[model samples]
Target: MAKITYIEHDGTRHEVEAENGLTVMEAAIRNMVPGIDADCGGACACATCHVYVDEAWLEKTGERASMEESMLDFASDVQDNSRLSCQIKVSDALDGLVVRLPEQQG
Candidate 1:
């Protein structure tokens, strides 16, 4: 299991255990974290699962695929660390990883 920290808009941190091989969005949705709408489920179609991962954790989180990169253009407040949580597979390597939730979604 991996420990993921979800940072809220008000700077609150919520920690939860994430199962390996699960998507970040799946973990968030399963844990009932706020801001991860996942309206399209785990599919790459919707950017509603957008999240900003901590830059320091980027290397461990791995790079985004072209599909994720292309979709981020539609994500609000896209940044260098922005990623679709649905496209990210969790692993023990992701333990202690932290992702910030965006304020809004379209």
Candidate 2:
């Protein structure tokens, strides 16, 4: 399993153990991490699960898919590091992955 950290805009931190094969969005929702609405579940159809991948873990999380990029257009405060958590699949390589939530989801 990968250990993922979800930090709220206010700085609240939630660390969760995500099984390999689960999406980071699923891990956040399962752990009840506030700020990740995951409105469309893991379908990559919405921006409610928007997050800023920690620069240190960006490569490990991989690039956003075309669909994810389209969905991100609906999110606020987009950044170079912005990502749709639902698009990031967990894996041993993603252990200790950290993502920061925006002030509010789209």
Candidate 3:
């Protein structure tokens, strides 16, 4: 399992063990991490699961696909490291991955 840390807009942190192959959004849901509404499950059809990948882990998380980028246009506070949590598959390489939630989901 990979250990992932989720930080909320208010600096609250939730660290949890994520199963390999599960999407980051799934991990958040499993661990009861607040702020990830995951309105579309893992379908990547909505921006409610948006998160900002920590700069140090951005490369390992891979780049956003065109569809994800397009969906992110509806998210609030989009940033260079912004990603749809559902689009980030958890893997061994993603252990210790850190992401922050935006102040609100758009």
Candidate 4:
């Protein structure tokens, strides 16, 4: 399992053990991380699970897919590091990944 950290807009943090093959959105939902709404579940149909990947781990998470990139437009605060958590699959490579949530979901 990968150990991922989710930080809310107000600075609250939640650490969770995310199993490989599950999406980051699923990990957050399972761990009750406060900011990840995941309105479309893990189907990548919504941006409610939007997160800003920490710069240090950006390369490790890889670039967002075109579909994910398009979906990000519906998020509240778009940034170069912004990504849809549901599109990020959990893996050993992402064990120490850290992502920050925006102030609100769109």
Highest lDDT model number? 3
Task: Give the clashing pairs for model 1.
Answer: none
> What is residue 84's positional error in candidate 4, in angstroms?
0.1
Per-residue alpha-carbon lDDT of model 1 for 1-106, expressed as tens digits? Answer: 9999999878988899999999989999999998999988888888999999998899998889998888888889998899999988999999999999989863
Q: What is the lDDT of candidate 4?
A: 0.91
**Model 3 segments more than 4 A misplaced:** none
Candidate 2 accuracy as lDDT = 0.92
TM-score of each: 0.95, 0.97, 0.98, 0.96
Query: Distance from true position, residue 52, model 3, in Å?
Result: 0.3
Q: List model 3 lDDT by residue over 1-106, tens digit each.
A: 8999999999999999999999999999998999999998889899999999999999999999999999999999899999999999999999999999999986
What's the TM for model 3?
Answer: 0.98
Model 4, range 1-106, lDDT digits (tens) per residue? 9999999989988988999999999999998998889888878888999999999999988899999988998988799999999988899999999999999987
Query: What is the alpha-carbon lDDT of model 3 when measured against the actual structure?
Result: 0.96
Cα lDDT, all candidates = 0.90, 0.92, 0.96, 0.91
* lDDT score for residue 38 of model 2: 88
TM-score of candidate 4 versus the correct structure, residues matched by position: 0.96
In candidate 4 the C-alpha lDDT for residue 89 amounts to 87
**Model 2 lDDT per residue over 1-106, tens place:** 9899999999999999999999999999999999999888878888999999999998888887888889989999999999999889999999999999999999
Candidates ranked, most accurate by TM-score first? 3, 2, 4, 1
Count backbone overlaps in model 4: 0
